[model samples]
Target: MVRALVVGATRGLGASLTRQYASKASSTVFATTRSSVPKDFPENVKWLSGVDLQKPKVGDDLAGQLKGEKPLDLVIITAGRFTTEDFNDKGPNWDEEVTMYTTSSIAPVFLVHALFHAGLLSKGSKVVLVSSESGSITLRHESEGGGNYAHHASKAALNMVGRLLSLDLKDAGVVVSIIHPGFMRSDMTKGVGFDKFWDDGGAVTTDDAASSLVEWTEKLDISKTGEYWAPRGPGDIGTAEATLGKGLSTPLKLPWRWLLRKAISVILLRDTALVWSLLRFRTRTAIYDKTLFVKCGLPLAVPADQDAGDDAQADDPDGHATGDDETLAMG
Candidate 1:
């Protein structure tokens, strides 16, 4: 029998996943909610109430509640909080940012750790962290502009947490998947004024997203653990065409190369002394030349020469250079 747990299962995708899992034969579904269990909740699903992710002891609370339960074959953390922000009018709200980070990023670490220590997660188990495409730095474009700092950064932090968890559990035969469950027409998005982009973004119902996630998790294993994926593809990613080009494939793997290159670029750009030292050592072998940039997954164009009209593009004609002159091309 498959024992699955869906955190934040009161509504939206989490609720849908709980229902679907409960319907499956030989499956036991467990769901968590911060409030009382809703009326007419699925009879088969075992609901655990008062499970707020923001609380510091949330993980311990959950582990204690499920102490005698069967080991979980799959665990999906779907809790999230979002708040809009803009520099011109609505600036970042400290309280909202704290709540968002705590719910989305911070809680997952504690929750998973407690579960592992409690022996709720065993070998061959799968852990899914429900992140967003907004977490992807490479997918960010000029079209989206800048705002919602905490909303975006929190998801990014969750992605990193997922990757680290995957590494830690690899030898234990546990798989950790970080995924963008696609744009969904949910209260969360509607409350954030994303409803305007629903039609244009190809946003689907929560049930649809949940279905895809369940199917995707079925195929997940140790081989693809630690990877970030968009199970519903780039159709809803506004910058997909502008940043990654057209005719993109489904279940897109958000690249880690861009993250690597951006990190290196940020270091070089912020530290003038480091940049100067690298420039001074330009007379060294080819390894010290543009090779270092290439190895770090950075653009071949030297950072010092960015303003020299050196707009080097990727070899692919469909590709484009980012504002920082980073080359992004579809493989």
Candidate 2:
């Protein structure tokens, strides 16, 4: 049987994802909620209510509860908080930024770590983190401008979290995916006053966005682990066309391969620096040789045509040329 766990399942995409999983007869779905009194969820779904991701005890409690359950077939952390910020606002909102970073990125580490240790995660398990395209530095364009520093930065940090987690889990045959779950016309967007741009933003209903995300997650495998993708594809990404151009596909490659490429780059740079230093050293040695000869007022060496014998000994009485050759060799 397929066992699925969806965290932060009270509303929005999380709720829809939970519903999708519950609809499958072969699946036993578990969901989480931060609320002590969350609106009732479906009867088929097991609810882990009061599972606040911001707190460590929450993970400990949840891990203990699921210890005897089947190694989770799937785990998706959908907890996220977005707060808009602009230069016009009264400085930066430190509290909101911390919430965004902790919930969206930092919490996942401890949660996953605890679950794995508790035997809730095993080989062939898939972990998904619902990040956003806004996290992508390459995807950002000047046309959209910038204001939500915490929102964007949190997602970026989450992407790194996913990458490192993927590396850690790969040897165990577990796959980790980071995804932009697509834009949705949900209360979260409305609360952020993004409804004004809803039409232009190509926002869809939460159900529709969640459907695509569910489908995308279904296709995940250990081989495709450690990737960033948009479940709904580039169609919904506002900056996709502007920044990435057309016809770009994602879930691309080994996330750590880029670091390998960078290491290769460093080697190349080191070789280049070494060559440059040697050239500089040689030039300096040549300059010093000329200066030394001039400063010492040493007589020029005998012409090549002037063969040695008694005359050569008389010309280099001080043996300065021999000492100069030794200096050049040392240099």
Q: Which one is best on TM-score?
A: 1
The number of residue pairs in model 1 that clash at the backbone is 0
* lDDT (0 to 1) per candidate: 0.84, 0.75
Q: Give lDDT: candidate 1, residue 303.
A: 42
TM-score for all predictions?
Answer: 0.80, 0.75
Number of the predicted model whose lDDT against the real structure is largest: 1
Residue 164 shift from truth in candidate 1, angstroms:
1.1
Q: Which residue pairs clash in candidate 1?
A: none
Quote the lDDT for 179 in model 2.
85
Q: Which residue pairs in model 2 clash with each other?
A: none
The 10 consecutive residues of candidate 2 with the worst lDDT sum are: 252-261
lDDT of 2 at 277: 59
Q: Model 1 over residues 111-147: C-alpha lDDT tens digits?
A: 9999998999999999999999998877878877999
